[model samples]
Target: MAGFHVLTGSGSTIAHPKVRRIGVSDILDAMRSGLADFWDRPSHYVFLCLIYPVIGMILLTWASTGNALQLIFPLVAGFALLGPLAAIGLYEISRRRERGEDASWRYAFEVVKSPAIPSILAVGAMLMAIFLVWIFTAQALYAWLYGPTAPDALIGFIYEVLTTRQGWTLLLVGNFVGLLFALVVLSTTSVAFPMLLDRDVGAYAAVATSARVMLTNPLPILLWGLMVAALLVIGTIPLLVGLAVIFPILGHATWHLYRKTVVAPPERKRRR
Candidate 1:
């Protein structure tokens, strides 16, 4: 994970963030390094984590009073899709700390002014689209399996899903569909987000580069995906507060992964 293994394969309009084969160790290392960055400014990540709960509280209010219980799971999964955007700030923090420079959260916001803004915004839109699709698909799956109406009581709904035979079907189908969407989001955004931040490249090129990274390192990439999913689920266990640490760690880890896996585009030799 420390040194680069430059990939010769090409994928986009311009391959600025050169691809490389990565292994399990690299992923873990990146995550560990990410955790290190989170501690570098724990207050910032705490702020990020707290902000997420207000939305969840609103959703909880809706679920308590309405039939919108189906929306909850997707919102959780959507966190992974949206992590790239959220991590932009963390990426900057990590970038600065790496260079022994000032690690300012406000400075991280300046990433928007980078020339990569168009590409970053484009990828952000793609993540948002996937999140919306996941939400609708989740709701549709619920309606198909358990009818459009959820139980008036949250405890009753949980009991039904856990104890009924139809509930098993719902879990099976819902997880299967969710896995499909997760793979799509993971493949496209895994390296693309960090790559865009580190390089000057078009959005399509950045996406293509990320796809190539997964293609070259399939098992490890899938492992990383599962880790993110697991972290999100675990973080939700404690009133969504654990996410304050976990989210930033993952974001910082992503930056490390990008540095480890992507070889910079080689400089063209000047003509004699």
Candidate 2:
């Protein structure tokens, strides 16, 4: 039988047991275990993943109507930025179970122990910076194209451009760009965080393996991606309050899904 141990919020030492090969069902069971109490004791898991920007938007909206529009660009950009961090919680839950320990809300913060925190943060920061550049560039281009023109001319031009052949071309191009981005994210982080947590592998390897997994299972992964996107959009209503419930469930479910898709390497026997 696999060894079992306890975990607490104050943090205590427990010996690491021998690693065992786990199946997808094992991961699913763990997810069910983690969320079992969520229904009856919702408060305990409410803060599983703290999305700062959501709160920032609420505050900005409350503060100024003028600044509210500004929040949209940042909110969209920020979600992309924090996607990895949000996935970290799933990694934590899976990692804890792999070690035969109880996973809890406190374990969500244990990702910092993986030595991957720096790389994760660095990658997230770079992505956010790039997105900011894109947002500004898009705004600048729109201003240059339509600014200093008569109001009627500007509106008419926009309508014409949107309905013209050129507009359809641009729309198709935009769709392709979005598809590419989704595929990149799906492949890179599909099983990345949990892999990193389960083993001593670097974040880069985790990303590489995740990408490989996506390449191997394109159809199912694509369906999964579309499902996640749809659910997230639905959860955004009620001012993102729904996320407090939806995010954890999805995070836990993803851990189970990752386990199903990626096989963990067996533990090497020690030389006697």
Candidate 3:
């Protein structure tokens, strides 16, 4: 098929995959399918869900035992940036299940030896970098607004944050900056990882294809992002337990989203 192609080290070339035009209804359909997948094999997904609460508890303990109380909200918000990494296993499950194979949860933890590992790790590093920078930036914004020191106590700090102009300013600016970071990540990886699993393409190609899909279907992509934000906020409200359910649903749904939005390359003949 005639389209764009990327040259490989072996002097051969592979055609670039195409992005599909998706709609708001497609996004909803993916989520619905993801939820069904979870219920279909709930036990397989249980342990993965527990991971979030464990991490939350550890963070809570660290803040309680340490002086870095201000780290709490920043860390909480940082989850938004790192959410993609945590969903890797769910992606695998979705992939396997899509083929009508047994979707055992154990496969989620076993070592993944696919050629896509390097690209997956590359994307993971990118996410962690964003998360660390976000933490530092959040701390600086807090220091600028409140003072050089974080609030001595959690409750007092909460009070000050609610009753001060500095807090409001910091909140507004911080959210704006975070939104930019999120959009960048979202645009870059919206379908990148899933594509990696579905195809043998390199990370750069996958990323470009992901962004292409968004541009091809802007309205649906916008609605999908908004829906993700709302779900995350709602999931965070119930002491983070909602994350167990939310994570798998979104993770599985994301696989479907990638499948729906990105078109695989058509097989072609190449000169040997």
What lDDT would each prediction earn against the true structure? 0.75, 0.54, 0.76
Q: How many backbone clashes does candidate 3 have?
A: 0
Find the 10 residues in a row with the least total lDDT in model 2: 1-10
lDDT tens digits, residues 1-272, model 1? 10111111122335545578888999999888988888877896778656666565666666566767766666676656788777787787777787788886776676876656677787888899998998888888888887877667667777888899887888888889989998998888788877766665667767887788888889999999899889988877887777777778888998998888778656722111
* TM-score for each model: 0.88, 0.65, 0.90
Model 3: worst 10 consecutive residues (lDDT sum): 1-10
List where candidate 2 sits over 4 angstroms from the true fold: 1-41, 50-53, 56-74, 77-81, 97-100, 122-176, 268-272
TM accuracy, model 1: 0.88
Which ten-residue region of model 1 has the weakest summed lDDT?
1-10
Model 2, 49-92: lDDT tens per residue? Answer: 44633664565464345423322433443464345556676557
Q: Per-residue lDDT tens digits of candidate 3, residues 1-272?
A: 11122211112353367777877889999989989889888766867777975687687778667878887887787887888777888888888888787779977753266545666776678788988899899888888777777578889878777788877787789889888878887888888777766665666677777788878998898788888888988888888878878888888998999989876546632211
| Candidate structures ordered by lDDT, highest first | 3, 1, 2
**Backbone clash tally (model 1):** 0
Better structure of 1 and 3 per TM-score: 3
What lDDT does candidate 3 reach at residue 190?
83
* Model 3 residue 50 lDDT score: 75
C-alpha RMSD between model 2 and the true structure: 9.1
Best by lDDT: 3
Candidate 1: residue 31 lDDT (0-100): 88
Give the per-residue Cα lDDT of candidate 2 at 23. 44
